[model samples]
Target: AQASFSQVFMGVAFTCGAEEEVIPFFDRGLPVEYELTRSIRVVAKTNRKKIGVLNTEAKLFGGFDFQSMRSTPPWPVVDELKKQYDVEQVSASEPIEEEYDALLIALPSSLPQKEMDHLQDYMEAGNPTLLLVDPLTIINVGLSPSEKAGANMNPFMRNQGPPPKEKGDIHALMTALGVSWNKAQIIWDQYNPHPDFAHLQPEIVFVGANNPEAFNQEHTASAGLQELVLLFPGSLRKAADSDYDFQPLVKTTPASGSLNYSQLVQRSFFGVQLVQPRFGHRPNPAAYTMAAHIKGESFPDTTNGADSDTTQTPTRVNAMVIADLDFISQQFFQIRQQAVGNLNFDNVTFFLNCMDVLVGDESFITLRKKRVRHRTLETIEEKKREFREEQLKEEQEAEAEASQALAEAQKRLSEKVAEVRQRTDLDDRTKEIMARNLQEAEQRKLDALKNKIEAKKEARIQRSKEEMEAKIRSIQSNIKVYSVFLPPLPVLGFGIFIFVRRYKREKEGAAAARRLRA
Candidate 1:
């Protein structure tokens, strides 16, 4: 069965690569092969550790594919972690092994509150648990009759509860970890002026804040993460009463935003606007709080179970929350191609980065490349950054080379001057004549050295001037390139996209008619 599956996989892989350029494929493929080999070696070094992945089943999630639900899988990193660590996926319905070192909970909010309650003991016993709070809804027993309308509303109502009080009871557990979900908040970036998003909508960019004691550089998961993507609108913030330190992972823009529950579910009649925009009537430019981390004193178990006698321990827990649910929707990924500044997959990368941190792997962060648009202004900025880096390197090399050259020249001149001074076999008059000639030669040598020094300085100065001129020229050229295409590059890309789409559809129809006739 394994051999058969491998064959099929190889076939699919080859078919996908069939149309790719052969030279490019080999160039890219060779390096990837070596990377995989190195990764395998690293895994071999680790003692197998168990990593529990808690997710909702299809029945509970309305036929959702639990394994395939995430915007990006944490499996790659988890598998790597397993090489040094044992990895396992625990279902919401399954019992957790007491021997497991770390637990990762990635499930919808509709999970039973009892499960979270059950895990409280393990959490308090110093085991690490990573929680991913689904976009908005959470699992709770406080669900009302109207809230449990169907599969669609069941989790939302069950987890989030009713109006007026937006924050859920999940805060009770999160409080132990010094983290609580900010149910009403949303991250929005008001500074987006890209042509596609300008008239359509404002993109949301979240920010992270540090909490010193709980989240220092020691923990691999929280290491080097500046910001996390807002998968949901709601966020996590530090609680007042908890002893553990809390740190922000995702944040909102400083655009006069709010966590008003009324605005989130505005009821509209006809075409009149109902709720005011969250950023208000004007614009602002600061980052707001969203996701957070807690690294100490997770919980105290007050359970009636048989394991109630287990000694209390100060455990660590990491949790992330995003308010908006639609951020992870397939529609968002599909429509992203139409956005300006080549904004496609920005959010996707953010999600993968979060998973990488949680799984303690740096590969995802290192492997991904930042997309650069072909716009003139953007190109100028790119060139400037590249040129500055090259210039600094060249300057360092030139300085070292100049110093070495000066040392060599000085050594030779000193030796020559000493040799000339030693000639005393001639008569006084001859000696004097030879002395004057030697003096003239020595002076010439000194002059040459001085000129060389000055030349090096001038060369450096000239290089700087050239660089400045080049930067200015690049900026002007970029302006001209974009100006030739009036409004923006996104508009041009969109027009071309539409034209190609229409042409493909027409060709497909003609081909189908021909096949039918044949």
Candidate 2:
């Protein structure tokens, strides 16, 4: 039995890449022979893509560290990236090496001109990069000393303002990519919100990929992501003459608009911070881009030896710019952590996916993509909303008119009864009975009128509902008929036509042959 099983296994193994096979039998059995084929060698994967982190010492605006804390492990995101790729901390002063697949600049407080030139050179060479920056720099000051030094002198005060241009190349790079970032304006959304941070209003906006107006579903970076929470995120607008193909990855809802954070902040007597509303004109509400993917030619290649004059070669450049950096901060991730469940937000996944795409490591994207359970329904049309409002108004007016008519009928009936009671010819009992009968008739009339009004209202409502249902059914029926029967009709008609033509041709041919023979 063992020999038989081995023979069957060998037959199957021969079709596969399996190599040498050895079959052993009991010592008492005769020598057993098994076919020996060439052994297959397995090669281990060792070449991991290199990811260079640029400007690790740059102070984050919100007093958050880009690297890990002293005692705690490095930011989970950093550690996660290290697992898949070779991560290295590189300084801005040094030239980015060709070995590095991509560069990451996370919440840098400043970028010197030398470093900017290096980055420009790197990107212009057809390399990809990720820029995670905040438009406004956050400063916490509890005393006068804190204001002078620009450092966190006091831990009690919270002051935020626009960062100086010298701090980083956010504006320059954004302009190059055809995106304009306004540090003074903060994006807010009243519709989609986070539960814990509801009091912060628009300062903390929750955007999901399923929102068609807010997220670009066509882009792979934002495709399957569920939700991302932006903390004091700045607004991103497209430049009119941008040469790159700008695709918005994340955006605020239609309820969002730019609010001046400087004017909105006010300190209360108890030292509590308050966001005061603007008294006069308000900014128009619209969707604003939070993150975008820009792809285009880096620059005109002018150094191809003698061919440089005749033909200009431009390398394709790809870069992703996010208006806010705090979304992926360790502090924000900790705050968003759930006590009992998988993480609620997809910030980490989004960051990783962006990095992967920038570095041309799209194979990692499939592992991070998740199906979100919470989905927002599609919005209704403005015309439909207006029609509903009109229907309600007409119903209210009808009710008021019915009530007035009933009151007038009752008043007239009462007057008639009183006049009949004043008649002198009628006896006392007769007069009493007549008045009672008149009162009963008035009550019946009132009840009938109420019934009639109710019936009419109900009928109208039912008719409207039926009409709507019928319209829906008609649309569904048309779709079904077209899908099931419309496609085959042409084919069926063609087949019948071919058969008829063939039959006619055969009959004619037979008649012609018989006549010729005759």
Candidate 3:
């Protein structure tokens, strides 16, 4: 699932094949190992799972916009989930009409207390929930900078104040479940870079992670996932009084910090810094939990005064809590002006895997979590970098040495010309002619020296390139030998040893039988 923007997955089943980069030199698909190229067939099942959505604000399930007086189209996430699950929008104000396999609550803190009670009733009844919480969701998406900030970059004559920032803070619900989200702050992860807005030098409210270290391999939902895009994400932490297991599935890098609104607005906190201190900074860098899975029995406190039959049994829930909701938004993942299905990150796959695992799709989970290890040829790459630095230094040294030699030669020629001018036996014309000859000879020598220096520089660069190439080839050959041939050697040796042991046993048995007959 570790994919750049230019790569895509190719497999028989959707989850079987790994991400493949289309190498330009090959003009075809990337050449991978047989296991990576391998795929398994998928058979569709009739009994699809059902997932309930609680937020109509996210427009996940398209609904009529009263302001626009038109029906807004549904998002791609709804369409994707509809393929495997029956998705329905549930009202927050009313009680959940029916029990579903799983429920999606986007921005859990935005709902009212009445709605939260309803959700508690549903969860207390043993329904699972995939809770997505974001610290700063875009209030007015797709608006120009003037419309967003209410002014251009001129920083003058701003009449209206900035729009109110929406945060997700569900202390009661999180306490009942397992974790607490610090919604007042956004997570700033320098582990991955968001490529856009680098030119504008705008505030880095956007954070992304495309490294394998960001995802926990021990967890099934987050395993094999490599990329996630987040906008103003929050941090998830275990509640002090909660007994549930709050295991982190995704984490911010140790280079990250829980950035407050003040830190976000400060220009000093942005861009690459030569010296970064985690010790006494306003917010120290730490590995905060961006996404997690909490497992335990639902606390009976929120279920009180509800219609749910709490007396039956304690509702055991396995819930996934994410610190960001923008990843699921189309504007965050979908590439504009391209195909609607194309994505810039693997957030959708990660969400789908979470849903699948929550719905208890064991077979699908198995395929999605199947990870194949591969090499990056770091040795050859390291050698290339080393040789480039070495070659550059050698060229500089050669140029300096040639320049010194030319200066000395010119000084010697000047001395000889002065000596000729001082000679009494030669005429002035002869001296002039002799000096001219000396000057021409010195010029030729200088040109020769320059030519030699240039030729040596080129040769040295070429030699270094060839040497690196040869070392890379040798490493590649050794890898092939180990992968293709070395594995069989141990098997062949074991076979020969077994054959000799069997031969000895048979001979001894035959000799014993003969002696008994005699």
Candidate 4:
């Protein structure tokens, strides 16, 4: 009966021109019901997932500006996120209306108890989330109420606010996730300095790839990042009781130290001295985790009786915690005239990569990764750079010397012509003839001098090129020689070893036979 059933299906598949599709069902002997279920699951997996941006307390998009829904300059990170995902602004006061796959919480100064409950509920339901927290919040103190409400807002307003205070609910959430957030301290690295923006405070921390302790190359989010500039970034550490797998994505250099914001503020203002020194006082300079990834078992669904089964397998939960929220803000991306939307930086790419990894959607990671194109020349060895500089200097000196010699030759020829023209002994006709001859002689000398200088310049350039090529060729030749001979050396040694062992064994066997015969 089974054979007959298979034959009937095969005939039907051939008639329907879907033999390949039917063959899979026949091979697995899957019922029609199972095939339909699998098809639905495949389609669901391919669909675009929604992302929720918590704007109620976080104000991630921007503060409560009724005129413009988005922040004045608008957050560039949101613009990038919209290109690939359906991003919806979610309020913590209301129940989440959209079926979002992930949530993004931009630096929130404060969250009410109700809002914190909503976030906790969302996270406990197994939804992935990314939290960008700031250790300090700077408010614009210079803007008046009228100027703030004006249509054209100045982007250069100076922001002066107190140090970042820890939000009780946010701290509780971090503890639950097994991540620790240092509320009182901010990171500063002496080894990695940033281009001074006069408007920004001295506490702003800048970290680059050159500072090995600051950049983690092992994580996917920060793998190819070259530099990250954080404005008053906080420090993060994993907690002992956390159940998730924790990995540091970004860090501060070994020269970095955590400064107490309260102490620094007292010293900056009020003319008070610190009781204890702040620099180089720690026993060991350690790299503090600036960003981290935590993954673990998801919360079980309790919406339905069947879903509430304790024996059911739990889903995987992924969350990314970044200490610096201002790093990805519009203020950081905008420099001078360039707007936040146009400027490309590693921080933006890193944020997008983190989002993609959290949601298990890597489709946009490659596209976003292409945004960072800055190639720093600092990677070149100092010796090689110095040699190149010396070559350039030699060329400049040679050109200067040739110019001086040409000037001297012209001056001498001009003086000789003047001497001949001024001679009183010569008659008018003779003087004119001698003057013409002298002018012609001067022209020939000038041309010869120009040619000589040109030849010298060309020779110098050619010599430099030849020397560079020679060095490159010498390196290549050494590599080639090793490539050709290195592999064969081991093989040759192994062959000789095997031959000697076999020869010795054969002789021993013959001697044993001879001894037995004797």
Candidate 5:
């Protein structure tokens, strides 16, 4: 019965960047997914199911309540979704194990490690988990300078040693999940740059593979993701064996190669530290840094759980790592117009689609249709606004044109009256009579011209009314949603029966009239 009401309500969790991007992408049309949590409860009938949502971070900003934080919340996407789905706000720490059919995790680098560990457990249980690991920062722990600066080109003489233990720990964590991250380089690409950054000299070479086979075609994660940016030096390679079914989803172009960590660090974060040769001997043309989805088993848990029934499940895990983490910063989000190449949507969408894989099919279909309808309606509205403005301008110009034509007609008529008054070929009486008749005729002509102008104005008004009606009808047609409540099948059949009976009665009455006439 709730589905009979034409609306979807969405409760958005403004807790993470990934969620933020995901919500708007689906609320409006683009190749992205919409998420529902326990925080928002959408009303659904037999076919429609309410999506429960949880606002994990809603409590921190305000009290442990969502309704109180409504005044200043910035998650408009959530609000838009609420119009179609039910929204609920919940704590971030709570595990959304079975409240909803699907899940979307948009945890940024700031999410707690313990939460991520819980998420890992969830994924191991065959639930879809989309992981986004930024190379620069993950959960606020970035690669230290000492960890990145190897012996190859430590021009600044910055202390260099074997990479830090934490780096290895991060790698081990990723490898256990079939994904790894190398913090040694920045993904420098020749094709893509923030418009402001494009003019500067790019040193660290990054490449996104031009070939289609570079990515896994079968996986849901890489769907519609055409390109990726990676750093040149110290990039993560595919550690899994070739026999492993997991495939590389993104790679660098052939002309690109990795740079040493020192050079990239010096150029990117630090001002120019070394002033030497502008160019150097290039290494391999390209190196494989980031790869997605290597099929493997989960790492054995060493916890001292006394329960004998506890068992780990073998499931396919999706992983993504880039050499640079700064790509997700606010700076990059601002480069929509200035950038020559692709932007972050490629990476954002890849992770989003993967999460959608974890969600229910009906939810995904509803979101897709809603997005298409909403965006199309918005575009049509914009067009209508523009058309109305143009029509108003045209009407004003036509009125001005009519006024100018009347002024010219009056001027010519006045000149003819003056010419008749000055003529000497006629007698006084005849000239006077002719002049009076000409004056009356000109006045009548003026009134006739004014009537014509008024007629044109009325015609334009009627045309405008008809046009507006047509536009309204078109919009109504677009809004006409199908529903069983709209004239039931039995009701329609009964109406047809009554119409046929009335037609037969009318025909019998016509035959009686013909008989009386005969």
Candidate 6:
């Protein structure tokens, strides 16, 4: 207050390290106060805990791809880390050195023996780490070698999921961390229904752990998280009689089911399955763990080579494992905050909290990401939202049904083509010609079918939408009129009544006074 009003002031000053890159505090991932404090601390102590990000096929740190003809930037999460720590991509093939305070391994798979040993040693040493591995992600299938070289791989494209070989223990680091992830199964949460195929169906395949109770409320990493969206996440459970305690961080309600890995990845087969609920019938009801810590008693026991005959000793596995990578990917968590820079969920906050937990520094965990607040008309929006969701779900179900039909038709056509191609009587040219004709025919038929289904869906949705829109418009119009003029009507009426009563009372008093004088 004194400085604001008076001339006396202490000039502000901050020192930057000789090697550290200096930038405005706004770009620093921490809150202004924390960033100022951290900057002050850096002047005295230049050393900061390093955070290593092992790049996967997804290419976390993107660059201009000559092949894809696109320039991509690092994800917001990674960019934030770079501003605060010595963030760099670490290779799995190399020895795990640099003494990273925390390591984030995404899409890990098979590992070389040497890398495996290094990773095992690193985890056993009580380093905080987070692992995100997926068996079948709908995001984009693995990018082409050339495209990945350019670092412009798009994950949202519909294509075949990663091949078995690309998943060399999927970062080959998951196995080393003692985090058991099944490269074969994916969870399908039924309670929080977000169906992938909007086909006409009663069953849903998309997984969403949307309840607060499903989160480990006591843990700082997951506390206050109301929901987590996972596409096809695997369950985190103890591996085959392994006693290592699996403390769950995120869980699915009993209404969750597991889908077949191979069948789900193949588009046609998966679409067909979506059309028909195979897993939905069995309806396995268990609170499956989607994310957890592999630590304490459940840690794998290892015996020193010199003492082979001795009993194995347990080591703390200070690691947190999340089954799906998309939850943290730019598409899922950072979607809403992209354009408007407001009204985002706690996804990024959850990630930041996990990072702080792993890095053993809670300094920035309480600070939220950049956000802008605005007012919304709740009365109108509430009704509109209800209608909009219903309409979207209906449309999706219709699309799912259309997709299933197309898949079946294509499957039949493919089987027939395979049978025809096997015949040796026809020359290569004839076979090629037949194949082309059949594909053309298949395209025409599928397009017609898709159009037919789409038309129907649009017509139905339009009708429902029109009806709802009319009702909403009527309600809104009424609300507007009432809001404009109805607010003061009661007050106005009450004032008139009070005036009339007062007038009557005063007239009676004057008449009585006059009668007394006469």
Q: State the TM-score for model 2.
A: 0.53
Off by over 4 Å in 5: 1-119, 137-168, 189-220, 223-234, 240-245, 260-262, 266-281, 289-291, 294-348, 360-518
How far in Å is the alpha carbon of 22 misplaced in model 6? 3.7
TM-score of each model, paired residue for residue:
0.46, 0.53, 0.52, 0.50, 0.39, 0.57
Maximum-TM-score candidate: 6
lDDT of 2 by residue, 181-257 (tens): 76556666644433345355556778865456666778888887777877767776777666677888897755455
Encode model 4's per-residue lDDT on 60-123: one tens digit a residue.
5656543233545447678657645668888877655566778997653355556766776676
Q: What lDDT is obtained when candidate 4 is compared to the true structure? A: 0.61
Judging by TM-score, tell me the better candidate of 1 and 2: 2
| Stretches of model 3 off by over 4 angstroms after superposition | 1-44, 64-71, 139-169, 193-213, 262-283, 298-315, 331-344, 366-518
Q: Write the per-residue lDDT of candidate 6 for residues 1-518, one digit (tens) a residue.
A: 45555563222356665744443424212235545565565455667768888755556687654334587677667865765677878776766766788988765443434554566666777777777666554444333111122122333432434532322333234544555566666676544322223342322233222344477877877765544566667777766555556678887765455766644433332121212332222335466777887766443444444565666565657888877766667764345334233324556667767777888877655544333333446676566546645555665566677668778887877877787788799998998889789878877887887778767866876787687668778988999999989999999999999999999999999999999999
* Residue 375 C-alpha lDDT in model 6: 44
Work out candidate 2's RMSD over C-alphas: 19.9
The models' CA-based lDDT, in order, is 0.47, 0.60, 0.61, 0.61, 0.45, 0.60
Per-residue C-alpha lDDT of model 1 across residues 268-343, encoded as one tens digit per residue:
2211122334322222334445445566654554565636567765465544433343344444444343453333
Q: What are the per-residue Cα lDDT tens digits for candidate 5 across 1-518? A: 35565655342344342233224332232323334432232322223333433332211122322222234433333443344444454333556466543333322223344454555555555544334444333212223323332212233533443441221234444555555455444343333323344343333332322344445566555543444433232355555632224566565543334444455344433322333222232334463545455444543443676454667544545333333433333333333223424343344344334434445433343343222211134444444544444444545555676778789889988998888989999888888898899989998999899889867865774576468547855765655643445647779899999999999999999999999999
Candidate rank order under TM-score = 6, 2, 3, 4, 1, 5
Which stretch of 10 consecutive residues in model 1 shows the poorest summed lDDT? 138-147
Q: On a 0 to 100 scale, what is the lDDT of residue 413 in model 3? A: 79
lDDT of 3 by residue, 1-518 (tens): 89667665443233424422221232122222322322212212345578888873556777765334578788778865765577888887788877788898876666657777777667656677898876655432211111222211223323344542332226777767767766566666433232233232111233233344578888888777645666667788998777677888887654456655434331221211112222211223457787888877744454466655555456676789987777777754344214244333556667888887777874555554343343445665455445534544554465566667778877887898899888899999999999889888877887887678667756765676477557756877888888898899999999999999999999999999999999
